[model samples]
Target chain A: MEKVIAGKPITVNEEGYLTDFNQWDEKVGEAIAAENHLSLTPRHWDVIKYLQNEQKNQVALSIRRVGKSGVVDIKELYSLFPNAPLKTATKIAGIPKPASCI
Target chain B: MKNLVILGAGTAGTMMANHLHHHLKTPEWNISIIDERDKHYYQPGFLFLPFDIYTPDDIIKTVEEFIPKEVSLIKSKIDKIVPEENKVQLTDGKQLDYDVLIIATGAKIATEETPGMEGEEWQKSVFDFYTFDGALALRNKLRDWTGGKLVVHITEMPIKCPVAPLEFAFLADSFFKNKNMRDKVEITYVTPLSGAFTKPKATEALTHLLDEKNIRIESDFAIEQVDNEKKEIIDYGGRAIPFDILVTVPTNKGDELIERSGMGDDLNYVPTNKATLQSKVYPNIFVLGDASDIPASKAGSVAHFEAEILTDNILHFVKGEPLTEAFDGHANCFIETGNDKALLIDFNYTHEPVEGSFPFPGIGPLRLLKESRMNHMGKLAFRWIYWNVLLKGTHIPFVSANMSDSGKHYEKALNE
Candidate 1:
């Protein structure tokens, strides 16, 4: 299915995960965040940027690795995304769902 | 030539296949294992799926990779087990006779037993993490979910991995806190037990963890039905607990084939001797893992321990000798307490979890009953150990099938 984000059309999987990473932008991130009832702050952007960069390198994201990434600690990451840190952060960052995620 | 047939190539059955393949000679005995599915799931990893601690690949493997070449692996669904005829009828109209039978069919989550549990809300708001699909579905729901009343519930006792629900609650607490929505989420743990856990001392320690995390507990909650339209779980006493998202451990019962065989208890678990692991009704039939009606916790650790005794007893029975080995129902589980910290609990049929160092008396690594980072690491490291060491039938260096009292501490009056 397709959803309009930031006046641009983006494709999503059956589970609502982004199907195309190239279509993602800051505006798209804002749209995703708004849907989840979250307002992305500077800290969320830091984690999102770090996650997007790590995804390019094909590294699996984990709570411990995110904490040690120097962007933010594990507690702060949880505070930013609440229930699903890697999932929400990656969703807004416009990366493919991490294979390590259920 | 004697035929030894094992049912359900799960944890207990797979381990038993390997254990016996090495012990029983080829010409004298033939061993075969049967299961409907071709995949073997690392069931403990199910708890981490919704939280993204583990992915599907990390917890699943092909069953053929684990079953040794000497043992025949039959992939077929069982229709019925005719114990009187000493044969098993398959769904495809095939039957296999067995001189010695091992029923390791294991237990399954019965979601349909409870009213409104599997209603229209199922997979939408009402979810379970017991199965692979359920965990994946819950993961999808959690991705975009805003904080609300997320209730972790247990339907009844004797479920596999009894401590898993508690682990989910702890992880949920950390999960919400990580998102800065801890204040928005109201976490409640509802159980049918009188305490936080089945045992006394462990309950005291775990109850404290719940209180420390500000998680509410509803004890002795016998759920009569789930009011899906209202999003409330109603108990037998007419007490109702409402939730926006309900994650439940549904009622667990043995495989339906056991019920068809007319050889199972009310819950479809085969009545077996707790120590010998032999079926109480049939001398030629044995039960292992979650299929057996043993008073032990239905955890992988208990199944591993039971495999040791059952393997020996099976040999003794074949040789027409007395079965001497006994199982003390040893079970050890790591309780995750969020924030990368966890607590280890070690106990058996008679003893509750206590405080002390494990494996050694004074100088040590792992601590019991106290939360520590090492325990969390140990819990994570177990995935590697399970695949490489446990399933391969290789003995872990320090751990034994039987619980030991060497390093355990007892209070002055409590000791007597």
Candidate 2:
């Protein structure tokens, strides 16, 4: 589904995670973060960049992986994005939520 | 003769050994399987062990019993796999060179990964049913214990037989009901995921079942630590759920041998070409079962399907041909949902299980995503089949290695 984010139409899934990474930008990410009541900071940007890099390289993202990524510890990640850090961060970064096989 | 060494004689390795032994015979290729353990466990039986539905004798069998006589079974602990040298070093100061290596070491619960999990109250109040010993101990504990807060928890995702913990909770409800103590126990199913399952349809069905059974669900809980003294599991989000008896599935990781070889991801799961089952770093090395970091569920049904495809791929690789047959991550599992009923789900990499018929598809017999007594019967009958047919690489009747979409109900967009 396409929704207006940062005054531009962006494709997103039902959960508001951007379906197309190409539509994602710093402005779009900030807008998404603001939706979750988070203001983008340098530390948040670093983690977002790391997540985007991992997503680009086709590495599956998880809280465990991000904690070990050295970009941000899990505690700091929770503080950065508040509740449901991975889900909120992935939404802000325009990546798919890390899913488990059912 | 060229050597093909298979590591671990568990379900995957045993099936592979049986599958390959017929195709790659004697003087051309020498097949050898190595594992430190002597007993071959019917791992699914571990779920029923705690409920006393199955005894230890029913699950434990000699590993050699399943292996073909033509293949060499090396009983030794592996120290490391030197992929660069194409050699597997044994702990007893021995090494075996292999032209082709199939690593099927599988995944195991790592209690050490979670702090306070294996602490003072390790098996007293805290228990795990993932292993034979753990299940047996839990059985003994459940025999005379007065029930209280029964927390059936999963510490992380990608655990083996993802439905087992849920089944444990379901069976627990019935078990207590049978013993006239249903009202005494408060059952809670805690998970890292947002619902009863990962898939939308299954989660909806299962979540409803949990509700019907009066089992409360605490979802999206990423556990930080288990407070042994307080008898509560604290999550990273500062959510603490108290438990009188915590039957938890700790973080499952691939064999440490993968990590020691420096050929694994963070969880020690080897990176593999999901379609071909070939190690991403080494073409000659193939990873099967839970050892590989595939998006597929780490279950016996998955390994069973993989053995069929990997067998064909191995033959193709040996003949200097491109691996054409791709494993679609087809897994057919029966989820036991208490009260002599179960839900059979057939899914692959892309497909989510929906309501339909299985094996015969449109024909009746086994239903998918809907609980039935026949499905439960199928689950029980699978034990006999696992030992007698599946381990021998015999194809199950009507069940294709690749998932069949003919009998399944799928939305047009998802049918692809």
Best candidate, DockQ: 2
lDDT of 2 by residue, A1-102 (tens): 889999999998888888889898899999998888889889999989999899899887888889888889887888887768888888899999877555
Clashing pairs in 1: A78-B178, A78-B179, A79-B178, A79-B179, A79-B180, A81-B179, A82-B179
Model 1 lDDT tens row, B252-289:
99999999989887678899898888899888999999
DockQ (CA atoms), all models: 0.01, 0.65
**Cα displacement (Å) at residue B100, model 1:** 1.1
Give the Å shift of residue A24 in candidate 2: 2.9
> Least accurate stretch of 10 residues (summed lDDT) in model 1 chain A?
A93-102
Q: Model 2 residue B293 lDDT?
A: 91
Worst 10 residues of 1 chain B by lDDT: B407-416
Chain A TM-score per model, please list them: 0.91, 0.95
Clashes of 2: 0
Residue A66 in candidate 2 has what lDDT?
Answer: 90
